[model samples]
Structure formats: C-alpha cells, structure tokens
Target chain A: MTAIHTGELVDRIGEAVLADPAVVRLDGGPFQTIATYLPGRRVVGVTAADRITVSVVLRLDQPIPAVAAALRERVRRVAGDLPIDVHVNDLESKEEPV
Target chain B: MVTTNSQNDLRDAVPAARQSPAPARLADENGQGKTTIASNVVQKIAGMAAREVSGVHAMGGGMSRAFGAIKERIPGAGTSSTAGVSVEVGEKQAAIDLDMIVEYGASIADLARAVRRNVITAVERMTGLEVIEVNISVEDVHLPDDNGGDEAPEKSRVE
Candidate 1:
C-alpha cells in the first residue's frame, strides 16, 4: 500500500467536503485570527494526528446533522477508518425556499 | 496459535472490503476471467430508482438543482438524472446517500421508507450487491406556491 501523506490526506478530506453541495466553504469563524496562515497549501482547519478534523461553513438549507454525517462518511471513503472531527463554524443563509 | 486462526476466521465473517465496496467480480468456472460492475453504474441505478418513487419533487439540494436548471436551459445541456444521488459501492455491498425535496403534504417518513425500499430492491436485483444502507436527507419541501408566487403579497397600504 502506498503511504498517504498528511498534506495529501488533508487535501482529500477538503475535496470530499467541498464537493458536497451542502458544504459551502471553509471558514475560520471565531478561529479566524488564531489560525496559522499557509500561503500555497492551506487546509486551514485540518490537523493531523491519529485522525483528522474538518471544520467548515455549510449552507443552511440542508439539515446540519445530516450534512455532518455525510461529510464523515465521505472523508472515511478517502482516509479509511481514521476518525474525523467535523465542526460547523458558520452557516450560509438559504437563498430560496423550495 | 489456534486463536490467531480463529481471529482471521472472525475477520472473514464480516469482510473488511465490504466497508468500502468496490467493483464486484463474479468468477465463473468457465475460462472467462470475471464480470465486473462499475460503481458509477450502481450510482446511476440508484438515482433512477429514487426518481421512481412518488412525492419526490426533485433530487438535489438548492445549489445543484439551480445548476441543473441552468444546465437544462442551455441549448444542448440535458438534465442530469443523477443530480442528488451518491453511492459508495463495495465488493459485496453498496451504500447510497440522496438529497431530495419532497412535495408538501407528503409524509416525510413514509416517503423516505418508500424511496429506500425502491432503491434497495432496484440495486440488489440489478447488481446482485447487498445494499448496506440508503440514507435520505429531506433537504426542502416543495410547496404549491413555490413555483409561481415569486413575488410576496403586496402589503395593504391602508392597514
């Protein structure tokens, strides 16, 4: 098995999350000023350890709990059984009602 | 020593590969090597299955449905049947996640159960893969006035 790098793993987790329609982007929220800034490669909230943590901004239309659960499953698809921590820092207001 | 073999047996009892189901291969006794079913095929199957259920107004969230609408308006862009359906196909099983807008007055619980049943039956019969789960998210409710009542009712000037 090819070894997975932390940066690459972070990238995958980011991609999996951003690809979901419910997830809008990664926002620092209250952690904005405190987070370290990496110019070229920035997965702002992702931290490497035994598992991964993903914090993001999500659209408010979809249910938050469901979106978080889906994100966990999506991350697992790439990271294997590595546990994930998902934080919803902010919510984008719903633009239109169905 | 014997316990280790038993541990392997336990592992085999619930195959780890089932967790992330991949393309399945059926090996026949004949010289033919194998028959593999791609995951995309399963995704499409599940998408179609979900669409077959009644009370499903649409298949995607706000953004994707908006994009789908735009794509449909374009000259040659056809509407996607797989807008809100996502699947992870494992070797012996598959898991599906769907985002949907249900018509108002429909029982969300009953609708979800129906959709799940349809999806599972369709996928299993077609691919011979066990459907581990069908997770449905009711993103929004499509009310009767949603289509035509773009403008809010004018406020009474004399009230």
Candidate 2:
C-alpha cells in the first residue's frame, strides 16, 4: 500500500526529471548544485520501475547536461526503470559575477 | 499506548530501555526499516502531479519550503513534507495542496482543470494515493513569451 505508492511516486519523479531537456541544461538548472534527499540519496542501488522528479535553484550560466546525467545515473543505480523529472525554479547564471 | 493487563501496564510504563525503540518507520518498504525515502517520495509525487499542466513552475513555494526548513531545525518533525501530505496507511491514500505559477497564453480555468484531472489520474495510477483534492492556487504569471527577456509581456496571465 502506502509504502508501495511512495516508491512509485519516487520513481515517477525521477523519470520526469530525466525526461526534461531544460532540467539537464547546465547553465540554469540545479542538478549538480542541489542537495538531493530520499530517492535522490538512494542512488547506490537500482530497482525495477524506478522514476524520480526533482526541483532546484541552479546557476543559470552552466550547462544542464551534467546534472541530468548524474541524476539519471544515480536514480538508475538506486531505483531502476525509474523516470525522473527535474525542474529548475530559480537560475543564476555564472556569466554574471556573483 | 494501551495495555490490557497490569503486567502489560508495567511493561509499558517501564519504558524498556533495553529495547532500542524501533527506528521510527517514516515510510517502510518490506518492513526493512526504510525511512530515508519519505521527503523525496512526497516531493516527487507532487512534482509528477504539478507538471502535467502547462503553467506549473515547481513544487515547494517560498513559504512552504522556508517553513519546512525551519521545522527541520526543530526536533519534533519526524520527517519534512510528511506533515503536509496526508496518507491512510491501509488504504494507501494521500492528498496534496498544489501551488503553481501559470504561464501567459493559457486559460486559467482551462489550465487549472487540465492540471487537476492529470494530477488525480497520475497520482492515483502511479502512487495509489487517493488524492482527495487537487486544489490549485495560481501564484504568479511571468512576462508573456513574446514580451522578450526582462520586459513585461503585453498581457499578463493572471490579469
């Protein structure tokens, strides 16, 4: 029941994050910079039907690919068959000096 | 905690120091004592629900995340975000209050309705959490897509 649903929920979010190109975009997305917990923290192992979704504020100037790849790999390692969607809310580009 | 008899009452009152209280099961899978999966679970569940619509920006509004972090510093919060998302253990049901920012060009009523339907369908099918209400609050609308960077769009989504 609830336990199962929660697992599915985690998987879906992961998928959603992985699917979004913008999420992978380095300059603006939070993939590498953001602190991931839970499903994100469980990246050491993989499971069937794994998907995850994440959100973060990232430096907009960087490319999003690294974040996406790292995230996907992490989710795959921990929860296999997982889909992750990571959305960026606030982005600060490195082009502009902090 | 309830005890049926005097012996049981003694056991309950005694607070068995020897038995390290079972790790608080925030959300267990296969009774393996898995608590590290609670926040990500709720966050992702809500994320799946929120993005189906055209306008949603992300989960955890400034206020909620801020307060959630604040609550984290305090000892009482067993888990973050769990307080917000409600659940029925046996029924495997859950509900969430969604906050979103609608983009320009989409109809508020139409977008909200579409979001509601999608959220319910996705959450129920994927998580088995019976969403009681996909209540939506359109927080803000950004500059129109045509308005160009930094400039306010000709028309506002909310107005």
Candidate 3:
C-alpha cells in the first residue's frame, strides 16, 4: 500500500496507466495535472517528510475547476493503493519566448 | 483610415519579417546586481528538475518596459542592465524581481509559490543564499490548444 517503495508504486502505476490508450489519452484534454506521491510514507515530522515524487505533468490545458475534477475522477478510476495528488492550475501561457 | 500594407501584401512580406533581437549583454558594475542575478537565476532554476511548475513570462508589466526603455534612452539610467532590477539585500537575506510566463491553466498562486519554493531551494542548495522573497510579474495568458489538456500524460488505474 502506501508503505511500499515509491519506485515500485510508480512502476506499477505507470505500467497500469500506460497500458490503456483511453487513460493515456487523458493526458491530452484542455487541462493540466500535477500529481505527487510517496511510498513507505509514515509521517516524519511535518508533511512530505517521506519519499514522494510527482509525475512530469499529466499536463492539461483547461481552467482550474474542470481540470481538477477530471483528474480526480480519472485517477480514482485508474489506480489502487497508490497515493497520487493532482494540482490543477489556470496559469498564464508559459509558451512565450523567453 | 489610410490602409498602408494590405493583409495579403503583409503576408507576402514574409522574407523581410525576420526578427533578430540582438543578444542583450548583461553588464553590471555593482556586485550581485538584482536584475542580472534575477534573470540568470530565474532562467536557470526554471530549467531545473525541482521546479516542475511552468515558466517565467516577463518581469514587470508595461511600466517596467517603459521604464526600461526610458532608462535605455537616458544617461546612466542603466537600461539594458539587468542590474536595474530592484533588489533587497542584507548580510544574509536577499530578494529579487522575476519576469515570468506561466503556461495557460496553471495556478498563479501555486506557480508563484512553486517558483518561490524552487528558487529558494535552488539558491539554498547551490549558493547557500537565503531567498526571502521573489516578486513575480505574469505578463499574459495564452489560448488553450484545441486539443489542449489531452496531449500530455494521462493517469488512470487499470490492472
């Protein structure tokens, strides 16, 4: 469960999610997702005191609400015992030339 | 209205639309100038792994640009000098202004917080510098792609 190694859970989750074209396609859409997780995380001192790493970006593009709702639903339908956090933000465009 | 370049005519002028803004040199006589440091730090940290946030758009708004141009036009105004960027420095604490462009749909507060956190993390880890604050100015919000959010990673649970 949550106590398992992060790598193992990441592998399991990645494999499971990548195995499905429908789920993988969810990475598209008009929204963005920032998910974090930690295995063997028992609570060190405060929060994130364990070993948690987030995904690159199930990067989406829509507004905050719709994106958050969809990611929450999709994640629940996709994984088991794997703790994932999805942060959806309606930020300005980062594609501009720097 | 006197129509000068027709849209079709303008479209035909593509061979002349080459934009090559000369690489602006960053020169500062002052030690650890705010603008120079902020630009370098922001660009570098954004390229790092821990940030994961979005990107930096611009430093301030139109006023900053106007002032920048004014400085550039004035004598010793330090235009073209990233050092012209404001800074608050002490024996051990420091803060700088940052220009940034975030991806559409990313949270402003969250992105700022992430930038602050990541920048501070980077500064601490790299320079042993304590970043007390980072003032971020978001310039614009881009249009979402028609296929917008569905182009990246997809997370779902399946055996």
Stretches of candidate 3 off by over 4 Å are A1-98, B1-53, B72-85, B99-101, B137-139, B142-159
lDDT of 2 by residue, A22-77 (tens): 33322212234332235445421222222344554344333333443455555545
* Residue A36 C-alpha lDDT in model 1: 26
Best by TM-score, which number?
1
Q: How does model 3 score on DockQ?
A: 0.01
lDDT per residue (tens digit) for residues B44-76 in model 1: 667778888989988998877888778767643
Shift of residue B38 alpha carbon in model 3, Å: 12
What digit string (tens of lDDT, one per residue) describes model 3 on residues A8-85?
544544444434332222121122222323544322111111222122222212222233334334443544322233
Q: Quantify all predictions' global Cα lDDT against the true fold.
A: 0.66, 0.46, 0.39
Error of 2 at B10 (Å): 25
The order by descending lDDT is 1, 2, 3
DockQ of each: 0.02, 0.03, 0.01
Per-candidate iRMSD = 17.7, 14.3, 19.9
Query: Interface RMSD, candidate 1?
Result: 17.7
Calculate candidate 2's fnat: 0.00
